[model samples]
Target: MGEGRLFESIGRALGLPPEAVARFGVDGPAEAAVLVETALRASGFRTDVTLYIDASRARALTSVEVATRVAPLLGEEVLVSPPADDPAVATSWFLITPGGERFRAREASPGNDSDCVEIDRASLRPG
Candidate 1:
């Protein structure tokens, strides 16, 4: 999907406003060109999104930094998962919904690794 459409879909799924969704692509055009794999779950849509940040900047980007930037955007009601011992790991944070559903978010991979945030639909229900 096109970047704009992709962000729109994500916003709809997560119940984020347009301005909030725009943060994902704040870096640049290429920043929003994330690899997204979506599935239809019994609750709703679940999406795994891998963001591609600029390699030059990614070298200094830590998982904590990525999480810090993302968590607040998900809103105050969402709970964040604990951090790993190593701050550089791709798996940084898991966003827990009010319904107790979990979704993961991480920093961009240094190599060709396909890591991303797994966003469960805002309407997700506890199973």
Candidate 2:
């Protein structure tokens, strides 16, 4: 589906007009984070994404499961790293979410602005 349609659905799910959600399409990473958070809340799940950070620098955005919902809208395939994987190296394991969003779950050092944000594994568990 086209990017406009995808955000429209997400916006509808969040009780917002398509125009509102469509705005995020051209927005930055911060908008993507807001999109995920909005979708998770609309799904009737907890919105608290905290308490899952493994390291002081592990930036937990949403859970793997929550992200799964957005994955379909992103594209055909989404790659998520297993929780058991070792901490990330400069060149190491990573997850590629829908829309080509790539990130590592753990990192030895602070990530740059271009790196992907981590998610909590516990967020993937079925309730």
| RMSD (CA, Å), each prediction | 11.0, 13.1
TM-score, every prediction: 0.30, 0.29
Model 2 residue 55 lDDT?
27
Error of 2 at 116 (Å): 15
Error in Å for residue 76 of model 2: 1.7
Local distance difference test, each candidate:
0.41, 0.39
Worst 10 residues of 1 by lDDT: 37-46
lDDT of 1: 0.41
lDDT tens per residue, model 2, 8-124? 544443434544432223353432323332222322121322212222332343445434554556554333443444443333334445664555443333345323333444333
Model 1: clashing residue pairs?
none
Clashes of 2: 0
Model 1 Cα shift for residue 58 (angstroms): 6.0
Question: What CA RMSD would candidate 1 show?
Answer: 11.0
